[model samples]
Target: MIERPITDWLPLTMKEVEKRGWDEVDIVLVSGDAYVDHPAFGTAVIGRIMESEGFRVAIVAQPNWKDDLRDFKKFGKPKYFFGVTAGCMDSMVNHYTANKRLRSNDSYTPGGEAGFRPDYATTVYSKILKELYPDVPVLLGGIEASLRRVTHYDYWQDKLMPSILVDAGADMLVYGMGEQPLREILKLARQGVPFSSMRNINQVAFMHDARTPLADYNDWSTVELASHETCLKDKIKYAANFKIVEVESNKWQANRITQQVGNQVLVINPPFKTMEEAEIDKSFDLPYTRLPHPKYKKRGPIPAYDMIKFSVNMHRGCFGGCSFCTISAHQGKFIASRSEKSVLKEVDEITKHPEFKGYISDLGGPSANMYKMKGKDESICARCQSPSCIHPVICSNLDTSHKPLTELYRKVDANPAIKKAFVGSGVRYDLLVDDFNKNNNDGNHDEYMEQLVTRHVSGRLKVAPEHTADDTLRIMRKPSFKYFKLFKKKYDQIQEKHNLKQPLIPYFISSHPGCEEQDMANLAAETKDLGFQLEQVQDFTPTPMTVAEVIYYSGVHPYTLKPVKTAKTRDEKQAQNRYFFWYKPEYKDWIRNRLNKLNRPDLVERLLGSKTGNSGKTTSSGNYSGRKKR
Candidate 1:
């Protein structure tokens, strides 16, 4: 291990820039998150990538947007562009809960304080920079920009907003894992190509004047989506547009997509191919301090950084393609996993950190067991356009194996400095169920489950079944609840064999599209029968760029044009969510009343232990305390 100077981090201030002897930075990134120089932090990754590419980069993190705009003008203007992001998460999501309530604390901010960044932070920061600099190009990236690249729903505003570029007034937008497009933009800029002329980069979106002929970029075909105005007027048209966008986004060889918003055309170029092992490794292997910028030492520690400081992400992208999730939308449906050597190197680095205590918090990714798995036939995958690879049924062309991940875990455990490495991320339990995914003839599923239960059980293992109703599960793109039963049986078998007491805490969502109140009641009743008190629950919040959100706004499934009932009113949503707490005394009367109104005496009897009795309060079968609030 080597001691690092303050200069080792990407310059977060003009003082740090002066220490680096930098006269002017090539790029200045403005982010909503407090600067944590870890790869898990998007701002750090983008800034470090630029530095690795021989660009003098400086970061202005969580700048004072509400003040007299001094923070916006501090860097003056970069030589190439000013990059803007709303941190790792969408700012609205970061600021508010699913109920649209303002959260009191921000995990990305120092001292877990809220309000450091404004809502719609990317648009706010970009607008400020455009006003201040006027000439320097404003480039938008990160999840906020990536998911909102086109016409999409905004849950907070309860409206279908046009592309973020239309409001942010930026020169260009780089969506998804931005390393590939970012490098291309940098190389072209180095050749003296102006940013305005660099519109052909993949995974980049920009507003083109509708009157002008679109630039001819290779021989790629284009798919025209319904205009923003049309989507606003017609919900059916909006729903249809999402299907096209989703399919194209997941395809390996995808068509360029365009949509008219007012006088401008939004052109979203197809994404770059999933990064190769070496490509993703290069981004992770960059020189990061792996700690928050030292200036925040007095402000107190960042909660998000604290949680993952000792964790190692094994891969990028998720093929699970859960409808409610934005992971596949932003990271793509293919998995780009890190090499074993790269993961081990990171583990060793974590061991050397002063705060590490012989434990690796997580050895997982978006979905823990998706490491190094992909389609068996490249040609089939290249031509396919389905948004999900393992929905309805697992594709035979796809390879679902847990051996690579299991082996990786064992190797990490064998490290002399490591006491335990846990898989903290949510596991896709369906992939391990033999009835659902038949690709496990090698008994890898059983072996992996045994290893995970015996070694990685950090008090309890978490999984997301999302819902129990078959109709709701189908609409959510999740497998039947029967598969979850199979998975739980296997999990419990392994636990009992090893004399372990780790409970499987399953996550469920209420008020999702196609989920009626009766469905929620049935969910509560069945889980009650299975000895679950229903702890991890949420009221679905519609975010941009997901099939579920589209359905919520459109009243119809994006894939299927048929109408799907969703709880829209506040009362309807609250009613559906109340079923999760059937055992609580506060909700016992409400549950009984609601069940009686729905004519579901059977459910009431099952949930309450009797149709009228109130003394039937019981907890989950195991020591499962719900998901802890972050």
Candidate 2:
């Protein structure tokens, strides 16, 4: 059970149940993939909220998320209901996994195909629910169903149709943080409330009005279908790349395929300014119950449970507005945080792990180093989910930095059993470098950086430089080279004083929006000079809901408000990647010869890309954010 603070206002239902003296209400929240005992978004937070409201909630994460008719027997029709998400919780995983088809739905499954896609999973969940529960209302909440709640575009069948409601067989969907919506639903349900009566709940995404026929699940341009077919099972893959085309006029469908099924078709709603409504203290006042996670799954490609994954969230949300990231899409614009004491408690528990050799802890969130909570008067810019902020560069509103985090690191280090603490999550270099000289209210300054080096890492710290070119990064919403230079300089000095030979790990991406040949030339040149082993070069895969993915689809960065080009072929990507290897002695001469043959002599260093993710960057959090959403 969660050990939350006493004064914080708990969910209304939680309070009501406690007041009413009820033991438990039977309820089940279903998903499409393996269950993570912890809450990434809905699992824990929503589950906790449910318990707070005095209802019993069980997360059946990662069920056979499909629209097929047969897969619904696991949790026989619950007396309460089912909650649905995509393949891997949300579009975020789909982004990281590169839109490849998952292995579960082999060629033999009725609606199965290779390459990771959440649709197949949702389809399975829907079909099973329809066949089994018949009348029990199924609610879809996660990214897959939420983002596709309208008839805007479909990547799979290459043509738009109605909402996932019809496709997945769920009666309705509640988007964003299900806290508010679920709380409302539960309160209403306990009082004998129906779905129609609970329509006014906040953060809920239901079929809008009754006039039109929302498109079908398989509706979209061929480009969308092609990529969705190839992406791995993750939430972002389904969300990243979609062009928002407004209805030509306000023409409803000629014939409503599923008349009542038509909710309003959603294009893109401004991220629900989750800030004004978010009760941070209440949100964070979770039970200090560091209990074992029975829902934890085994790791893939090796031993499943490697000392049970424990996570420490340093920050949340992205102002970077990268087209390919969905943290901005899912978590909303606000950056919420826990107090240092809270973080320390979590770390202390982690140190108690039986397998604690102290290799690494997942000290990450959307952007690990971005624990900077902004000031109260963000009056200059009210929240808008239009995919960007109107800032000149990085917003100054971020008063919360990682200084306390560093101190917590030091305290954790004080434990003799914990030999090291790695930042396994994304190091928002931009955030860390932001007031580098000015030691802030968080107690210490560069000490965090030093700890990042001397303690967490074995030798290198992974930093996502994303792309070397300014234009590309501008589109990607990542920091500029000047920032990297400063980070590298700080990193180098720290390395020298500590007599640490570890190189600063920096990752680069190829074929992002707005990348020109000269950009590739510049990247190659940068890579060759960086002098570190560049292990991996990545090709761009557009996931759903990310600004970058929009750039991939529209050929423009949503924030930059500019036109861009996506690389058209594998050969083009190969050509760009070739530059990264020119510095390796083993392949240098040969690669150099090829570069010379192409008449591009200066573009070697820029070509470097590292699979190890900037082996020089320091972090103890093993859960790294790939291609950090600006």
CA RMSD of each candidate after superposition: 1.6, 9.6
**What residue runs in model 2 are displaced by over 4 Å at the alpha carbon?**
1-25, 40-45, 59-71, 87-119, 146-166, 212-308, 357-360, 381-392, 414-418, 434-445, 557-562, 583-599, 604-630
- In model 1, what are the clashing residue pairs, if there are any? none
Cα lDDT of model 1 by residue, 1-630, tens digit: 234688978888788889989898899999999999999999999999888889999889899888678887777679899999999899998888888899999999999999899999999999988888898899999999999999999989989999999999999999999999999999998888987799888999999999999987967899999999999999999999999999999888999999999999999999899999999999999989998888888899899998999999999888877888899999998999999999999999999898788999999898898999999999999999888889889999988888998899999999999998898988999999999999988999888988999999798898989899999999989999999999989888887888988888888889999999999999988887788876557779888999899999999998878999999999999999888888788998888888898898888888886745556566665533455331
In model 1, state the lDDT of residue 135: 86
Q: For residues 1-630, what per-residue lDDT tens digits would candidate 2 score against the true structure?
A: 233332222212334335545454356665544433333434556667676776655545444334543234533455566666663244433423333433343221112323333444565566677677787777777667655554423433333345566667666677555555666678888887776555444445454354643333323211112132322232233233232311100011111111133233322222233433135434544552333233231323111122225556655565545555656555655565656665666666667756556654566667666565554456544532233431225544445455667766777677666666667665767655644324255544476787787777655577777777877776776767777777777888888898887666677777776786567667756544554445566666555455555555554554444566777466666666655555454655555566567776543323423433322222221222233322
- Provide the lDDT at 188 for model 2: 83
What's the true lDDT of residue 38 in model 2?
A: 36
Best-fitting candidate, scored by lDDT = 1
Global lDDT of model 2: 0.52
Q: Candidates' lDDT values, in order?
A: 0.89, 0.52
lDDT of 1: 0.89
